[model samples]
Target chain A: MNTPNSLLIRRSRRSSNLSFVALGLVAVGLVMMPYVVYQSVTSSMVMLFVLVIIASMWNLLAGFGGLVSIGQQAYIGIGAYTVIVMADLGVHPLIGVFFGALTSAMLALPTSWLAFRLRGDYFAVGTWVIAEVYRLVMIKFQFVGGADGKSLVGLSGLDPVMRSALTYWFALGIAILTVLGCFWLLRSRIGLALTAIRDDEVSARAGGIDATRIKRIVYLVSAAGCGLAGGILVVDALRVQPDAIFSVSWSAYMIFIVIIGGIGYLEGPLIGALVFFAMQQFLAEMGTWYLMLLGVLAICAAAWFPKGLWGAFSQKTGFRLFPVGYHVAQRFDTPVDSRAPLFRN
Target chain B: MQILDALAQGILLGGLYTLFAVGLSIMFGVMRIVNLAHGDFAILAAFLAILLVGETSFPVWLVVAITVPAFAAIGYFLQRTLFQQSLNSGPLSTLLVTFGMSIVIQNALLEAFSANPQRLDVGQLATASFPVGPIAIPYIGVLGLMLAILCIVAIELFLRRTATGRMTRAVSDDPDTARLTGANSRHIYGLATGIAFGAVAIAGLLLAARSSVEPTAGSMRLIFAFEAVVIGGLGSLWGTLVGGLSLGVVQTLVAHFDPSSSILAGHLLFLLVLAFRPQGLIPARSL
Candidate 1:
């Protein structure tokens, strides 16, 4: 004796057509943005692409996998160092970018085995230790500038016009590809499993999900993305310091961007990076207080809103900017017999 | 003889490490929260002592007397205001919140006292040392070890002997049951933070006399304390001491042979221990 009005459970779904249209618009907009900015701003644009790419991967891992890590610098350091290692052997950083990621994947393979042993706090600590190990190990390699951090002197001698354009285009392609990859991944069945795992790992496992394999895949992907991004970072900086490249501060910045932009969603780090860059415009002169401010902001965000800005915005607006999948619905006004038939069919 | 000397000194330093870690252990023992700010609090206390002594010309004991209760009060407030509510949210929230508190405290201290390092001139304690079978034992180092032992004994006794101790143990065991038994678990949480702060005070006294005081000193101390806690196992008090000693010995041995290996040696030791036995050296079985 239930009311027909109460029987309708409307699932929110974007028609596959609207989703593709939205993607095309965003692609066009991103393509057109570079002509509108200054030279330094344009140069910095490439850096931002890499930053967002790496931060997005981290955001996906921590925000979705419930695998809160503090040592992602392991991959970043590895990637950059790998690029340098290749460069020492006379491989161009441009060509060695993929190799750098490969190196990160190799490190992650062993690290994931060991780091997976640690749950929660221990995991964070273990990852940090691993990063330290990477840093220490790097110091033992003299070709990459043990402590001094060698300059990419020869790279500068290459045709300046070709080099800059190629690096920019390379970063752009990677950024776009990573974003698309994340979107596709999130829209898939594995994405559904990831969200399920994030919500509750035990239940997800009980539901026949290969939680470990899923997490490993996510970890490996995250590592590879970080590795590629890191190589680009060194190329941009033109030199890589063991301390700076391997710094925990990079991870901290990644945390800051994700927190501010909104974690869990693909666009969180994108928004976060933009917000962080804007804030840096003002807070850059604040010196050490600036770091403290970012930390405090992240803490406040976590304390007040665990769902992050993205979750909060979604709840308030009832709209998703990046719709991964569709929700099919049956109108409440439809006859029960008709609705039942439609559902059954 | 050199090896023996290293071992003895390591054991002695382990005492200080024990002192450094026990307060953190006590907190974790009663409440399953790890204060990422544990080492920072120790450094802060030491700096406070330095400031206190400079201002009032108080003896080190008097400084500790003042700082212990003062820090206990701060810890009590920190728990009552912030952590008490978040306890049920589990460790992640606790870690983030405490990490925030650490940033607040470190920045506040950094602002109050710049990045310049400070040290205490502990009269004879700093330089005074006696030979034990060809090993030089500094008075300050001996003090650190003795304090560590004292800390262990006192905490163990306090946890076992007193009615408050029983209540604490009960609360730690099962908060709901303790609540049913008419113990206010919230108040107990404050007391736990207070006890932790008291232990930090002792560590601060010993640490200031031992090392140069700087803002980042907390994180560094925290690193050792963390390693000790891990080495000792999750919740055991004595194991912390063993953990500290083992870490100290490992570091000393590395330093003795290869100066560069000192920090690396400690990290590798921790990794090796973790690889084989993640349960730690001494696991907290009861709570």
Candidate 2:
């Protein structure tokens, strides 16, 4: 028996070369999307961008932060209302989107204080109640057309083509930034802390992690992302309504996308958003049936494939575009010795 | 006089709310799973009652009597199948599955019944009011209150005295130990859900008698029931009634001052309670 002469220290592979190539191609395609796609297609892409952003943020919250909120529609509604109100005050709709996000983040601070009181399922319902309160209160603001809602006032001056293009670009930029921001956050020290907390809260706390502070930050960030998406949605629609914007269906859509694409994976939202968009394009005309199908699909997914489409695919292929977990690789140079045991179990 | 009337009306309103929440309270207490489709199930019961009355020439009361047992069967079947599978997965999976169920039920109802609001006419009972000193309360309101009280008492007694109910309590207390003691936890869960559905069916009839119901109405009802459950405490049956009454009174009082803020007032109170006393006003002793 020969003793091992060489030792290798293993480190997890972060990304494949193929992943970088794919990312490059996707970035270029997005940049030239306005020229490559028709106006109608561009408009639909706007919807896709907004959906992806919202779904990704939701994934981060529930997938990473261990906070499953069904009330993100509150921030969406608030953000839309903020843009509409700002437009009323003679501000450019473009500039108001940031303010909308800022306002949402501010509101999230107080909301987290209240929402964090409850644990698990209670938190889900509590967030929903907060959203309902926001909707009801918005109906009383007679200046913003109250229950009827209002249209964004100042966008009529811009050319239709220019406005659409700009909105599309803004959405694209926001979607890219949200994905990168989440990826960056997850790779940071806080991300490791979050992963620990997600797996076992008691143990994480016992390990000296401040679960409350991390959760608060994640909640605030999610609100800001949803807020920006909401702003973009109103801008694309050119109208805002309390009933429509504050509808829980928005949250449902986000959940569906996240669940279908891959709940915890980084690329899951993009894939989920595209699948949803395709379905919506084809079946939206069927009206209630389309919604029923979505419901059925969501239920089936939760029951049969809780890990989602990407999750199952990754398990089989060992492929990850945005790999966060570590993977060990064995060096081929070390000769196997059956009696000495080739590798540590 | 106005304030007194408002308070009386609010308390009466709370009776219906208690009926809505008792089912939720039971399901939560026994299984620790908050059924997101609970409001949709109640609305489904209402629609079923309406269909029965419309198709057969059965009277409203008979329709309710038939529907209650039918809903119980549905509760049992759903628990044994879909809910049981999801429960094994985890609490979050159960939540998502129920949420999906809610969506499916709402859309199916919309497709079958259309979006038109439907009401169950109970002839003279709906409009008839009796004088309680200076206040006049509708007969339906009194009936709802009496029915709610009867249901709560019956459930309490059942849980305390009956063999199956004791089994349920045992399971709720400790599922693993209950299993070790030879109790079938799944069957117990199904029974609890069945009872909960029966209660919801009765509540649905009361709701239809009081006002119009549509497919979308389930969402609001869900919020109200959730609020009442949270306010009352997680596993406490009697506390649910008190929570419902408090919510009703608060809404009515706000309505008396400003009608538009009535719903908002209840939600605000719920939030305040959540923020200040996360354990709830009358927390369960087991917790």
Candidate 3:
């Protein structure tokens, strides 16, 4: 749309169109990767995708929605448990992934009621405690393997290579969907409301935004995204352990990735996940030192580079893979009057 | 008889839990900073005591006495530098930086001490207890309770009577306004953090005396302390006491019937409190 000022207003930039095509090409390439890439490489890709999904979900909640929950492992565990338990009951693990998202979103409803009570820092701890509650509760349920955990059954009938390939494919598909989901969500009217609420909740509320409701929606979406990651995680690992699935380390990893990559940017998690994957590949043997390195890196990122690596890069290059903001640019076709006044002045 | 015995034990446990929580309370109350590393620092203090005990021929209590003041100094230094920077960045930065610190400390301890659980040797104090009819109260439990009461009283008195305490409260209430009134918020925050660190170190030492602690033990303590703070109410010291005691009682009572469900019971109680009374059981009227 062009205003009287001869400027066009639009959401998508020229780069976004290019990014869309690039994203498509990458998706197609990744879809064919399992067929050509080594099985071990495929497994690693699955983990990378899982990290990307969770990190993005966390970024959505914390960065955009301003809800910094350190307990998202609650949904991850719930997702894994749901998928594995469904496998026990004669459902295919592939189809169970969607169910995982559904179940997580369902669970997040009750969770938000309890968790949303606490402000800022307290909310983070509240979510974590809630996750702990879920973990402890899951341990008591003997039907789904209880404290000892259970292996993913029903997959034994399929060929090992086929199962791995299927898992890899699902991971890739979901990772793509999660990224696209975030991009689409952020470019919508809800996204506008989210930005308003994040910048100033009181002003946003005064401006007629349903701040609580919008935040709840974002929280549910994030929970669903994490749940999808967890389902794929179970399928990839072929087991479900309450402690392992519900581990706070997942949140740590998510927080670390978001902080280092860029907390509020859509492209941040993708970059952070890649860096994390490379670090993991090289430093897997370092054990606790590797974790310490990650911790130190995260602290440095939060302290020195609050905008994160991508945020800095974007600021310098003025590049964006996904642009969620509306921009105004002067129309080139009608720009002929340098002598005319630019404004009513 | 069993219930009464459990009740006594729970109360003693409550004292230790309060000790774990008060430092966290002060940090939040004063600086509005949630130290995610609170539990890890406690474990770090316990480990420091262990190292001291290993190096010297001194008793564990003496080692703890030495370690507490040292930890206070470290806390003051850390807050003045690292925490102050994060606080300037915003709450997200504070959470991320502290969370990162937590992971770093946990991993460092793991690398230094391995995964093996270590405990402080209290000698006869480990077994010494006084009989109250059917209930036997351990000497260490009584000591912990006494020390907890003393610490709380001391802190309360310090906040009420001392000039530094008044400045700390002013900063807690409004850092900018306090600064306008000639108080240095950063210095006050450092002092608050120092006291918190000292208190938590004592909590850690008592925990080591009570049970074996490993590198990974910090997160559990973090949760317990956090739960106590939330249940009792934020920014209220006595509320923390109440929260800790109730949490202790609930866990013990549940464990008496089903051993595995004790921790779960505490979490449930916290959630119930959150659901019904989000302001906490005894909400803070003033910092």
Q: Which whole-number lDDT from 0 to 100 does residue B219 have in model 2?
A: 81
Q: What share of the true interface contacts does each candidate keep?
A: 0.27, 0.69, 0.82
Off by more than 4 A, model 3: A1-6, A331-345
Model 1 misplaced regions, further than 4 Å: A1-27, A32-34, A159-162, A324-328, A332-345, B88-91
Q: For every model in order, what is the iRMS? A: 2.3, 0.9, 0.6
Give the chain B TM-score for each candidate.
0.94, 0.97, 0.98
Better of 2 and 3 by TM-score: 3
Best DockQ among the predictions, by candidate number: 3
Docking class of 1: acceptable
Candidate 2, residue A315: how far the Cα is off, in Å: 0.8
Across A1-345, the per-residue lDDT of candidate 2 in tens digits comes to 223523322323435557857887988898798887888889988999999999999999998888989999999998899999999899898888888899999999999999998778768878999999999989998999999989897888899988888999999999999998998888777888899998898999999999999999999999999999989989999998898999999989998998899888887888899899999999999999999999999888887788889989888988888756655544446555436543331
Q: What's the ranking of the predictions by lDDT, best on top?
A: 3, 2, 1
Question: Residue-pair clashes per candidate, as listed?
Answer: 2, 0, 0
lDDT of 1 at B275: 82
DockQ of 1: 0.47
Model 2 reaches what TM-score against the true structure? 0.95
Cα lDDT of model 3 by residue, B142-176, tens digit: 88878777888899999999999998888888889
Compared with the true structure, what per-residue lDDT tens digits does model 3 show for residues A281-335?
Answer: 9998999999999999999889778989899999998778898876664475565
lDDT of 1 at B98: 66
